[model samples]
Target chain A: MLGRLNHVAIAVRDAEKAAKIYGAAFGAEISAPLPLPEHGVITVFAILPNTKIEFIQPLGETSPIAKFVERNADGGIHHVCYEVPDIVATRDILIAEGARVLGDGEPKIGAHGKPVLFFHPKDFSGALVEIEQS
Target chain B: MLGRLNHVAIAVRDAEKAAKIYGAAFGAEISAPLPLPEHGVITVFAILPNTKIEFIQPLGETSPIAKFVERNADGGIHHVCYEVPDIVATRDILIAEGARVLGDGEPKIGAHGKPVLFFHPKDFSGALVEIEQS
Candidate 1:
């Protein structure tokens, strides 16, 4: 079963500005900004009482986030992540259902320091989804 | 503080198809399709272990969801809802921080039967956010 809504991620040209908006408006406690070169993104987590909002900004010219921001211009919600009790099982089941898992078809250590898998947006209609081990 | 990630909503042309996909892939329990005429949408909640994934379909020609689907063609993630301890207080605080709360600037009974408020997408950097009283 899906454990919980892990985090909702937004792709922005400037995540600091987005984080500031959440901080100033909702008084959200935001994390120190983190840069993941391998992921080609800079990330920050706006911690809420029960969940998190992730602000993602492109760290390189060819980052997928950069392309998203380019298409949306004003930026937009990038993806939503869900926590799963067993990500590997989740992956196997999703694969059996004819869904395409992105990347190398294996779990990778994500920003949360947990095994995570990404599903193709097409598989979920349009929303990109991430499943993380809880 | 925002209480929890209430639900991640997706606007779809066919919520049933989406629900079926989730049901098949994750074996999730889905609510009966609910039509909210006032909101001009049909909604179904895929119950997970800790959070909900809401699938929304336009019920009218002029629905904002219809327009979103038109623009996106394939539909996409629409908005995210967060639970708050007090909806009115959250509204006031957001206003004080110069964020525009949509509609009448007052809380209304939402689909969850809780007081809720919608924030302008621009204010939150293109993410439409809903704050619902927990």
Candidate 2:
């Protein structure tokens, strides 16, 4: 079952620059950008009380978010990650409900080092959703 | 100062149908659709532990989100709302930081019956941000 609303990821051209307002105006603590070459993204986190806002930029030419940033230009909400007690079980349930899991239907080690799976946007009414093992 | 992330609003064609996956697959509590003609939207809430996911549909032809739904046929993440201790102060600070506040730059009574203000997406790296009084 779904647990906490983990974090919302925003695709941007510059992760750190995109998070500056959260630190300067909202007074939220922002983490320094960290590159994950395997994931092809550089991420910056704006730590909030109950959740976090993740700003992600492309780490390489083949980055998964590269097309998203190109399409959005100014950047946009890329996906929402939710915590699940059992990701594999959750994926099976979602598949049974006619949801399409992205990427060969296997949970991958996500940005938070948890097993995670992403669902296709079309099946979820145009919102890409990620389920992370809690 | 910014507090919790209140909710993420997703613009969809049908609020009830859009929230079905959360209830059926994620086992999340989904609220009955509530029409706010004044705001020109019919909203259904998928209650998560840390925050809520709001599914909104246009109420009438002149609804504000009509254009968004038109642009994104499958629906999409519309805005992210964050809670603030003092909305007025927060708005002033955001403005002083060169962020463009949407509309008249004044806090309006939001769907939750609390003062809220929206920032232009361009100013927030292409993501519409809402700040509500906590």
Give the chain B TM-score for each candidate.
0.93, 0.98
Q: Candidate 1, DockQ to 2 decimals?
A: 0.67
Tens-digit lDDT track of model 1 for B42-113: 999898766788999999777768888887666798888988887888889888888888888878888778
Report the Cα RMSD per candidate. Answer: 1.8, 0.7
**TM-scores of the candidates in the order shown:** 0.92, 0.99
Candidate 2 global CA lDDT score: 0.94
* lDDT, candidate 1, A66-122, per-residue tens: 778988777799888988888999999899988899999889998768999999887
Stretches of candidate 1 exceeding 4 Å from the true structure: none
Question: What DockQ does candidate 2 score?
Answer: 0.89
| Weakest ten-residue segment in model 2 chain B by summed lDDT | B105-114
Q: Pick the candidate with the highest lDDT.
A: 2
lDDT of the candidates, in the order given: 0.85, 0.94
lDDT of 2 by residue, B1-134 (tens): 77999999999999999999999999999999999998999999999988999999999989989999999899999999999999999999999999999899889999889999999999898889999999
